[model samples]
Target chain A: MDLLYQIFVDPFVQMGTAPDLLVQTLWEGLVSGVLYALIALGFVLIFKASGVFNFAQGIMVVFAALTLVGLYEKGVPAFLALALTIVVMLGLAVLVERLMLRPLVNQPDIVLFMATFGLTYVLIGLGEIIFGGDPKVMIADQLYLPRGAIDVNMLGGFVSLQKIDIAAAIIASLMVAGLAVVFQKTRIGRALRAVADSHKAALSVGISLEQIWVVVWFAAGIVALATGIMWGARSNVSFALEIVSLKALPVLILGGLTSIPGAIVGGIIIGVGEKLGEFYWGPLLGSGIESWLAYVIALIFLLFRPQGLFGERIIERI
Target chain B: MFYREAGQYKTSYAADQAIFPVLQDRLGLIAILIVAFVVIPLTGNEFLLQAVMIPFLVFTLATIGLNLLTGYTGLLSLGTGAFMGVGAYACYKLATIFPQVNLLVWVVASGFFAAGVGVLFGLPSLRIKGFYLAVATLAAQFFLSWCFIRIPWLYNYNISASIEVPTRTLFGIPVTGPTAAPVTRYLVVLSIVVVMTWLASNLVHGRIGRMWMAVRDMDIAAELIGIKLYRTKLLAFAVSSFYCGVAGAMLAFLWLGAAESESFNINQSFLVLFMVIIGGLGSLTGSFFGALFIWGLPIVLRNAPGAFGLSITAATVEHITFMVVGALIVFFLIVEPNGLARLWQIGKQKLRVWPFPY
Candidate 1:
């Protein structure tokens, strides 16, 4: 008992003097949580408007990031390169609406979902071929994010906060707030809600399905681009980010596909939970628990609250 | 016609209930079996049996498995690859622990492990439906895949985290691992696929299959008709997973002789899903036909450029393959949403009334 206490409990007791490592992990987790929320935002945008679970949203994050970095390397200025990338995402949105969604307007949800999976491969191959299958720097310094950390004293311990994390949190919050206003207060938001309510009725009311699709897709594109940038800054920007982007699947499950607020709350819950669990309790399981902890949490969450935190309760009547 | 079924009718209930009641179908099946069992072994080279035939057979089994759960039961799953991984790991553990057990016994029993996990994953289906259910199953995919990577004891803590297939044999014939003869391995895989396909077919044509279809078409209607949706759906998951488990074990043991988590990623799940969709939803023939086209097309794409006068790089071929396959999926959905099997049935119907207007 004395040996165990000195070996395990001593770290927490010593934390009163120095907690930089603990705070750093939490900071890292927050930045990643922001990126995850960004990817989940893209998924929620498409699902809310189209009722299609866009599995390709992860690839879209990679595609947009790769496009931005790939073009910047080709001599486009960083900001101009970012703009060009947005244009490319918009083009992708337009192309998808015209070529894929329009043709299968009333197809089964599963069919549409599968089509997005096909879209995923299309983007994967095309993005690889065009951008080259290599990880690149996200030009964090050029964007003036920062490279240092801030230390604050808490509970007789000093906690370190990275500038990149502060930037990510601020930027993500602004984007989420902006998106919330657009979804709630704008004319386009009303149209989107109407379309979401009933595709046939919205079409009957002269709301162009094509136009709404283009708008929502473009919105998803922006979300993807922002996600790519923030996530790129954390790790090197690369195609390997696809796996991390896929983490958003469990996040979406926790958040619910149809609720924007659910995404934010779910993102934080998973983010903080995974981070804390990995730091404190991961050693109990030999570490690497962070990798699948969110999923475990979501699985248990599904058992009790399958509707997600803010999602509409699905009730199927005979 | 020589293929006609005349003078071959069954007079007894037992005979009529045979797996292949039609004489021509039975004969055709026997001829196929003979070719696979005899001629291929006698004439074919090692490469054909190992690379193409073995993997194709295993994936065909998995496609059949997915077809049962997703196509017939209308329960969407994105965890097919993970389920297959469960089977492979389970088989590996079993074979290691039971050194004296026959290879075939271990393979068959490995499926029970996958089925057990599949049923646990399938539990959410009783309460969820549609897109929600797909999400739920994806949890199964990640959770199981996580188990393989994290649970060191499950994989015996290989430093590189990849399981190396151990050499094992049956009847003095090397059937798996590096030393295995290609022909012996092919026969082993072929035997499993043949018997399992028969089992799958029998199940699909029986009362259980009808109940699954009823649940798929309309769960409320199925319940109203006195079918217990919960028990039936779980059974579909278990049976489907058993087939996938055996397929996964075959893939690891017979085909690759080694595999990493990469082999069973979500991409693999998507490939099988596409096969089932392109093949057909509610048809056993669709599973076989879909597996052949989806799995075989890539090989043909990789090689066809070489046969032609033009030289195409492998990268370009991969790119072109994606574009072509993607277009075909959309085309299939647009032209005949019921898939390739429906198209085949239509062709058969057309052949019956050919050369004259009704």
Candidate 2:
């Protein structure tokens, strides 16, 4: 009975007792969730536009950040490096569409997916070769992202919030809002939606699939850049960040493969859930449950809803 | 001309149903078997046996395992490394527990443990398909990997937390551990891989294989046609994990001689998947070819610089190899998405019709 209480009740009791800690955990979760959502947003954009599950998105994030940092280290101004990085990503997008996706068009989704795996390898090798494999600090101060922490007195305890976290959340929200506006209120957005819905139909109506693909991939690249900056500001920019970015897969699962809002909500849910599970129940499991907790959460959710929260209902035809 | 099967005739159903239907094919098979069982063993040096051939065979087995599911049953699993870990850990525990028992038995038996875990994780495959199922398998991958690290009991409370392979003799000949001769370990691994591959080939050619393939082609259609999708998919998981388990056991025992959780991380899974996809999705022969190419590419690349007397640093060569391998994979995928197996088939077809353009 005590074991059962410890399993089910004690975590809640702790939460009730230390509300400030709970808030702190939630804030940290939200920040990480925003990062995860940003990664997933990149995934959703490319997946929706190209039907290619770009496994390279994570590496693209690292590559983008690496380019930014590597250029800054080369004595380029931070903002110019940032712009050059965007251009590099755009170049990458065009190269990918031309080289990988064009030839592999009409292949099975799995084949395309594997092609992205190849893309991932190429990016990793290229990134390491160019940037040197060591981790580099994100130029947050030069970029003017906020620093320090805001300590709030609440519930008889002080919950310290990192100003960087607040900036991340705000920037992530602004980016999402901007993307939403662009997606909803633009001519290019209409073409993207058309291509996303039916490639054949879009092509028939004079929308160039190739051009749209390049555009969508470039957009995904930009998202990767923004994500790289925020995530790198939180930690050192390194290839190891690619592994953490894989948390976005579980996030994608929760959010659905194609839904932007689903990606956001799913990322937050996975982030908060993983944090809470680790903080409360980690000791019971020897304290490294954070690695698999997100996956487990996603797995449980998958059992109930295979198509995910915002994904279209799957209907198969013989 | 030698590849032609013009005069061959099958007088019986059994003859018609033989795996190698052509006379040349049977001869080719026998020749390859002779090379593997006789020629290579007698001529191969310690380095060849230890570094190239054994790892190749080990990965071939693992590739076959992944191919069985991803290539045959249409279930894309990313937890192969973890399943392999289960087998390795299980083999370790079993060996320590029953010191008197044959190590080979434990290696084979460990696959069952992996199969059980595979089935447990594969339960989600019924509801989830495609990438979702892939993520579900990642759950298995991460969770089991965590278990490998956290549960010291699996590794017998070792300080380093790595499983040390105990010396095990086969008919009083040392086949594992540092004391074991590479040739002895190679023969043991070879025999097991051959037998298991034969079993796999037979399975894929038989009714069970058809069921898996049918499900792979279209699960809903297979179900409507009265092929039990649940049983078939689960059985695919079981058998695939079984193969991977044995491969993992051999990998740790016959190849690495010692292992920690790092040996079976997500990268291992991806590596095996790359072999499967690059080899050929649905061809057993492709598994061998895929393993050989993917595993051999790095060795060849690493040696090529020295062979050419290039003055490049090892790290630079390593990075270059990565680039080349990456570029080659994409090139191969573009050139023949069906994998090297299909290319082999095309070659054979061209050889058969040589001197005449059809």
Candidate 3:
């Protein structure tokens, strides 16, 4: 009975007593969820267009951040460095499409997936060599990202919110809205949807698979850049961020791999769930349940809905 | 010409179904075994035995473990490191509790513990497939790893939170612990690896392996053929984790001597998976090739600059090694998506038809 009370009753009581802390935890989760959603958006963009689950998405986030910070450290202005990073990402997309994707056309999805693992290694090596191993500041001040915190007094206490987190939430929503428009309205969008449906049919209709791959990969790279800046603002820009980006995987599974909106909703759900689990129940489990809690949540959800909340139902003819 | 098999004839069903049907292959196996058992151990220095060969053989076992599931069973798992940790920790606890039992018994038996954990995590496999399943396995990896750190009981309440292997003897010969000679440890690990590999070969070529392959090729079709999908997949997970568990136990007992949880992290899982895919999925022999390439290349690259009289920082060499390994993975995949096993097959084919285009 004591164990049951500890498991179920105590955490809720604690939350009720410290509602301010609860609000703070929720805010933190929202900020992290927005970041996770951004990373998952990059993954969804590439997976939908090419049917390739890009395992390097996490590393790409780190690499993009490192490049921007490295350039800024070398005395390039922030905006110019951002432009140069975008150009570099575009060049990377072209190179990948030509060198990797072209040769690997029609291979099994797993094979392509493994190829991305290779891409991750190469990017890690290159990034480390060029930028060095030391962590760098994200140059958020020069970029004019907001700093400090807003303290809200409510429920007999205070909740402090970081202005940067608010900006991140707003930016993420705008980007999603913009992406929705582009995906729904543009010619390239139709071409991407077509390629996503059937490669042969897309080709039959004169859609260039190679071009679409480049565009989508480039677009994912941009998303990765924005994610890097936001995440790096929160912490130091380093290879360690690569592991954190893997948090996006739970979000991807929860949201449905191919659904943009699913990524957003999944990200928030995992984010809030992770924070709540860590805050209320972590001590009972000896702490540090946050790492796997998201994955466990996704796994349980998968037992009931294998296709995910937004995923098309898998129809196995064979 | 000497490799020709035209005159060889099998008079019995057992002879016909032997692992190496070709006379040349049989001879090759014998030669390799002789070198492994006699020649290399006799001449190899301490570094070669301990650093290069022992870890190579250990990783080969782990790769074979993962190959059984991902390659043969068609389930892509990312939780191999956690499964391996279960084995190592289980062996540690069992050995401490029963000091009189042969450590070797506990080592092999530890695989059952890992197998249990693997099956528990693998329950979701029946509902999910592909990347979704892979993510599900990540839950196993992270949760188990967290448990390793958080549960002090698993480490026997050690202040350092590491498993220290105590000296254990077989036939009164020291085979483990800090006091054990490198050659003794090597021999122990090699023997276990060779026996496990042989068993794996037989298993892969038999009925259970075929069920795994059928499922891997197409689960729905496999299920239609009256094969129980859940049972077959869980069996694969259990068997795969069993091999990994034994490998993990040996990795700690015979190789590292003392190991922290850091030794069996996600990177270890990725390293074994790399070996499996780069070596060739679904081929036991390819596991060896994969282990050799992935493990040996770094050692070679690290030394190449020194041998060439070029002075470079150790960190730079490490970075270059990563770049080279990454590039080679891409190159090999582009050249032969089937992997190094296919290359070996192609080479054998060309050798069989030497001096002829066809």
Q: What tens-digit string does per-residue lDDT give for candidate 3 at B200-282?
A: 99898999999999999999999999899999999999999999999999888999998778888889998998999999999
In model 2, the number of clashes is 0
| Greater-DockQ candidate between 1 and 3 | 3
Pick by TM-score: 1 or 3, better one: 3
Q: Model 1, which residues run further than 4 Å from truth?
A: A1-25, B1-31, B156-160, B312-316, B319-323, B356-358
Residue B278 in candidate 1 has what lDDT?
82
TM-score of each: 0.91, 0.99, 0.99
Return the TM-scores of chain A for each candidate in numbered order: 0.92, 0.98, 0.99
Model 1, A83-178: lDDT tens digits are 999999999999999888988889888888878877887887787678767788997877677878888877556777878778878888998899
Q: Which runs of model 3 end up more than 4 angstroms from their true locations?
A: none
Better of 1 and 3 by lDDT: 3
Summarize candidate 2's per-residue lDDT along B1-358 as a digit string, tens digits.
7788898988999999999898888898889989998998999998899999999999999999999999999999999999999999999999999999999999999999999999999999999999989988999999999999999999999999999999999899999899999888988999999999999999999999999999999888999999988899999999999999999999999999999999999999999999999999989999999999999999999999899988888877788788888888899999999999999999999999987865
State residue B5's C-alpha deviation in candidate 1, in Å. Answer: 9.3
Query: lDDT by residue for model 1 over B1-358, one digit each (tens)?
Result: 3444557878899898886666767787789889989999899887788767887898899999999999999999989999899889989988888877898898889999999999999998887777667767877887677678878777778998978878787887777778988888888899899999989998988999999999999999899989999999999999999999999988999899887776787778988999899888878888888888888887887788888867877777787777667766776776776778999878755554564433
- Which 10-residue span in candidate 1 chain A carries the lowest summed lDDT? A10-19
lDDT value, residue A153 of candidate 1: 77
